[model samples]
Target: MTVRDLSALFLDSTDRPLPRAARELASAGVPVFPVAPRDKVPLIRHGRGFRDATTNLAQVDTWWRRFPQANIGVPTGAASGLVVVDVDVHGTNGYDALNRADRAGLIAGWEFLVRSPTGGLHLYYPAEPGAEQRSWQAGNAGIDFRGDGGYIVAPPSLRVIDGETVPYRITELATEPARPLDAGRLRGFLDPPRPPRRLPTQMRGQGRTGPMKLANWLGGESTDRNRKLFWASCVLAEEGVPYRDALEAMLTVEQRDFGSREIARTVASGYKRIHGDPRLAGKNSASGAGTARAVVDAAPEDRLASARGL
Candidate 1:
């Protein structure tokens, strides 16, 4: 179905009874599934969440009959030919970040505006044909993109908040032409990439000399910071630096930017990469007294891909 048709369907059925609204949506060829009453959790038994959504009227009728008060869940992205940019209000005030994005022209093109039960906003857009837009969350900005592999509770779906049941409501419908949101562009604006920090020429091929110097340099770096930390940790490992010392150095430099767990994981990955498995070096084992060198030849992107959550 066209985005216009979907928008009209939602606008018309905003106040309709939940079961009838769900059936109407299915009849219009929009796949839907039952969610728990007053909750967003899918109610289908042994179902793989939104993947089980269907436009089959018989199935739709059967589901609603079985769970009369169930909320309607719509799978976003190509499954329903729509995507959503969700602006959350809870922690960071997403409207502020959204306003910044709007000023940059990155948040226009929405066909429908929905008011979530939590006082957040869901701006719906048509899925760009043949392009897969994956879902992502920018927690610091309190905004999320619901694209592929995501689902949204449709209008009239009720949520229980503070002992009260409130409905997700259709707030506005576009009168002018609508377009698809460039999710990538919006993400880039929200969390712009920082330029890579280059290792000094003197440090290159020095074969593990001046491990403290490496730590000092890393302290000032903030771009591809995790991968750089991994590189430094590998160098330290090759020099037979103890695991404890390496952890101390990485934590000292990156504690402000990364969690202790992430720092520890990256350090462990680097050491393991060089040693087959990580080992704590003996205190008497010479730091910067390099053994046979293991090559660190992977490019930055490859290295980043290999590291988890970098």
Candidate 2:
């Protein structure tokens, strides 16, 4: 539908944008639930999930009235006639991958699209009526299908990080009513053939992983920010990346222009904790959680301190 067509359905809700947006989406026959304003967490307490989304004007009004600032949530997959091909634009080269997918015609015949606050794209398509589609991951293909048990925060919702706000917007509005997403098209997407095993290249051995881990930390919103840094450091250190290089890469991705060297040192401690130890240094440590914790317990506090630099 055109922007005007969509906008026509929404009554001017200038005083309270979130509540107005929610009501407008519901009025268009899309079931909606309230998310904490400016955040994805549900505002309504109790067992409510996306399954509780309703198009009922009375219920919608009650929800927005109680939590006037609540963000809007729409369940994906077949239930709401939407299957979102999530193109994450963060790490793992999502932007390139999305372009390739589109070139390969993996994405077509749909129009609804939402740009995620975290630099990702949520491509929405209508699902086939009565289709029991569920959410699934497409390996490291950098795309996710948000169907069944998944929800999308509706547009007009702003995601704030580090005092900066990014709003999700619908880039492509459907001209006609969305049809249920096609099964064949979805299968082509969700189940691409696994490639033959190949040995790690030089790039894989000493590339991407360290920077990706660091990016994760920089982009994190965890209260345990210090812990996250420590964790990321260890991962990078294990990859054999030098402390200085790791710091530069992380800072670059995070867009920090300057900071004391301590930030790098603290992050590198994670690397040091792993490399200095005989087990992980030798790469003989068991993979996964057990080994991860052992590495943390071994790191010195001086290295894991959060406020060392800033």
Candidate 3:
């Protein structure tokens, strides 16, 4: 049997015993990536600011609510699979081909699954003579390969469609042929290399300092430009620009290329007429009125400052 065949078996089962699968792969000389069960963890919803799998499972429930409809024509949720690494025996010994560093790199490539706080395991396989390693990391998790007598980990939830039990014999599954990893053909994989040292700029406003502020201001989370505008303002504020002045700068940029001053003035006047009245406070239109006031107030201040500087 080949690595592809083992992959097929792993994919086919939805309820198989993972330990048995690991042993089979080991016996076949195939390396397997394992995932452990995690409870009470949150999964991120793709393309949205919301996270699934919170304490109340609000996020998970929300995901399920939107998932069926969202993925009508596509695959939804997570997928389970394995990765095998092979070595060139003619050129180098199997162990020499993949050392601790190579195993670390493999884990780094699939770190997202671990960072998700989702329960998953990673497995490492030393390259064997006459075998090739396959490099595939995306939408998958890896198993840890450190320490002696360490076994490949598998998820108990993995199973076949008809629910046939897969045995836990590493030898049965490990004997499969290893896939070839060609450096030239796999150049694209190396394109997005990791940076050696993280820059301070990259660290700024990432966690609580950034998204948290915007999430608070918008009542829910701000979307696109709204969030950006808030963050830009924050950055400007950090750079010594007053919060109000930063907002004004953004608005000035919006209005500078207006084709007609008269039209702009007319629109401004209309807004002032409707919003200049105080009666609109504490009403259905109050939020819109406040936003308009913020923009109008900021724009003039920015323009005045720019004029003084000029």
Name the lDDT of candidate 1. Answer: 0.73
Give the poorly placed runs of model 2, Cα more than 4 Å off.
1-16, 173-310
TM-score of 1: 0.64
Candidate 3 per-residue C-alpha lDDT over 1-310 given as tens digits, one digit per residue, 9 for 90 to 100: 4334544444443244334433444444443332222221122324322111122233333443443211100011111123322222232222222332232222122110101112122221223233222233221112212221222223223222244532221111222233222221122222222222422354445653342243233233223322233334434344443333433334443322221232222222222223331332332232222322222133323412332211
Arranged by TM-score, best first = 1, 2, 3
RMSD of each: 18.3, 20.5, 26.8
The lDDT per prediction is 0.73, 0.57, 0.28
- Per-residue lDDT of model 1, residues 51-148, tens digit only: 89999999999999999999999999889999998878898877778766665556666776677878777888899876667788888898999998
- What is the overall TM-score of model 3 with all chains considered together? 0.20
Best by TM-score: 1
Per-residue lDDT of 187 in model 3: 20
Q: How many residue pairs clash in each candidate at the backbone level?
A: 0, 10, 37
lDDT of 3 at 124: 19
lDDT digits (tens) for residues 1-310 of candidate 2? 3323433332243234787778777877778898887798876678677789989989999998998877888887655666677766455645455555444434554545555677666766666455455666655666677787888776777788678876776544444444444333333334433322431243345445656545554555434333455556656676677776777665643323223333453464465456553332523122222321321232223212321221
Clashing pairs in 2: 1-174, 1-175, 77-147, 126-181, 127-180, 127-181, 128-180, 128-181, 234-270, 237-271
Rank the models by lDDT, top first: 1, 2, 3
